[model samples]
Target: MSFIASIGQGAINLYHRIRWVVSISTAIVQLAFHPSSWTKPVRAVLTRQIVFTGYDAIGFVAVVALLTGISVVVQAQVWMGRLGQSELLGPLLVTVIVREVGPLLVNFIVIGRSATAMAAELAGMKVRHEVEVLDSQGLDPLVFLVMPRAISMALSVFGLAMLFVVFSFGSGYLCGAFLGTGPGDPGIFARSVVRGVSSYDFYNILAKTLIPGLLTGVIAANEGLSVEGVATDIPQAVTRTVVRATLAVLVVSVIVSVLTYI
Candidate 1:
């Protein structure tokens, strides 16, 4: 009886979370497409979000990507040579660096940096009744606040993923040249990369990056907005946002990887 009761309670909790996710996701979509949501004040909010989430993330993302690239180049040279497939260095780099590592790392960074911050900020507003104050003032908080942050966050993550790809792959190329991977021939490196990464790979990586960004932003916004009562709720919301964002990204990445093959 005890086990059965526990199972039922777990399902009930899951159902509530699913409902919240669906409701907030629909709200974000509606506001994202609604032109009325983009007034002057909202635009200012959006611009600030872009600056904070996107521009601020660039330096760290670049450094991480560069380091990854350098490591990949060294490994690719050794492994490919041992396999007697040294000519496949570019393709190996493309697959490991661009397809998997780049998107995953950028998404992780954004979740840690921006998602937690957004959750705490929104929770703070809620705890202070500022969101309710906006309600009384005849402004929809969704339009005034949440949706812009969601959209900006998604864009920021996507932009950062691109930066990751460039710096990581570019650094890998430089590493290869320095180590004479192609015996000082850049053409070999270029051809391998081009041949290795197909149009399908391009589309798949984009989907992986874009979808996760949108989901992370929406989930973080939802968690923050759901906070109710007390000073302690803010920290709790922030922690939940981080955990949920990490799990959501992992699930979405797995689904994309499977769907691409199908």
Candidate 2:
């Protein structure tokens, strides 16, 4: 009987996991098809997300990018000086900013700042029965709430990523010039930016930012929807949502990198 009970519990857990996946996937597909779900009023949500995720978080991202750029330049100069190929700094800086740092810094900022707040806010609403209240009024909670947040997150991430690239490259250039280790040619930097990044890389960057935003938004919403029982469950749901979303983003990023490169 104990063995049977254990097996039953495992089956139930598997069933719940599957249900969560299916429900979130269905919600995403439904939102994609329903343009009205993300219409005008939803623009407010997008604006809000941009303010919080992009503008407010810019300081942290800027500091990190500046330091990273400086370090990259310093290390590259040391190594390239030994190798007699110091002229390669332009291409190297362009590659680092475009291919790696830009997307990564954007992801870290969004996941830490916006994604966690979104999960907690939705979970709190669920605990307070606000979502149910919306549902009782015949409003589709997924369309009204979830879709706006998802769309806003995706747009904000893409925009912020582009900003990060520009800022990081500019910072790197200035710092390298100050340190006397730079290529010292803005024209070369501009040309490298134009030539080094292909259409496919842009598409991959877009997908990386947008898909993770969607996944984080949808997963957080689903976790909120799953909240049941006492008030404590709300925080628990938020925590679970964050952990799951972060893991999902990391896994998806790796897969995207592999698929894009390999």
Candidate 3:
């Protein structure tokens, strides 16, 4: 009986994994074919998401970026000073901000603010049977609900990343200048950024932001849609969704970065 139970559990796990894959694939195909779903109404949702995920969180992003830039510039200044290559500060700051820190930091902010809230909201909708009601009314919940959030997240991430670059560069320059670093020139930093960041870099950053946005949206929606049993399940599902979404974003980011480098 124990062996039988173990086998049954394994089968259930496999079935869930298969269902998750099928659900995601179906949503992707549906989204691709139904461009009209992402219209004006969707734009409204996206706007709301931007307000919540971008505008509301701007202060936090600014503070974090400021500290991060200050830290990096100080460290870079010290290292460059030792090597007598202080002029490398501008290029190094640009490269670090554009290639790595910008995306990572923006993602962190989104995960903390937007993704988790999305999960919780959807989970609550699930708990309250709102999602089912929409479905029963012949409304496509993915279109009416999930797509907007996904688009918003992608656009917000891109916007926030750009903002982060600005804040980081500005703060870094100010901090370096205060510390008597001669190479912390904003003009040089701007030139290095223009030179170092190509179209390919922009494409890479967009891909990173877009994929993670989609993943977070789908994962949160799935978790919300999967809620069953007790009322406590809603919070549990939200927690799981956040964790899974965050992991997925990290994994995809690394894979894309590696592929881009290759």
Residue 226 Cα positional deviation in candidate 3, in Å, after optimal superposition:
1.3
Give the clashing residue pairs of candidate 1, or none: none
> By TM-score, is 2 or 3 better?
3
Pick by TM-score: which candidate is best? 1
Q: What range of 10 consecutive residues in model 3 has the weakest lDDT sum? A: 21-30
- Which has the higher lDDT value, candidate number 1 or candidate number 2? 1
Q: Estimate each model's TM-score.
A: 0.92, 0.83, 0.84
For model 1, the run of ten residues with the poorest summed lDDT: 180-189
Global lDDT scores for all candidate models: 0.82, 0.73, 0.75
Model 2 CA RMSD to the hidden true structure, in angstroms: 3.4
- How far does residue 99 in candidate 2 sit from its true spot (Å)? 2.6
- Runs in model 3 lying further than 4 Å from the true structure: 1-35, 182-184
Pairs that clash in candidate 2: none
Alpha-carbon error at 188 in model 1, in Å?
A: 2.4
> Which candidate leads in lDDT?
1
So what's the TM-score on candidate 2? 0.83
lDDT of 2 by residue, 110-198 (tens): 87787778877877787789988888976678776787777667777777777777777777678767777765677865674566566
* Candidate numbers sorted by lDDT from highest down: 1, 3, 2
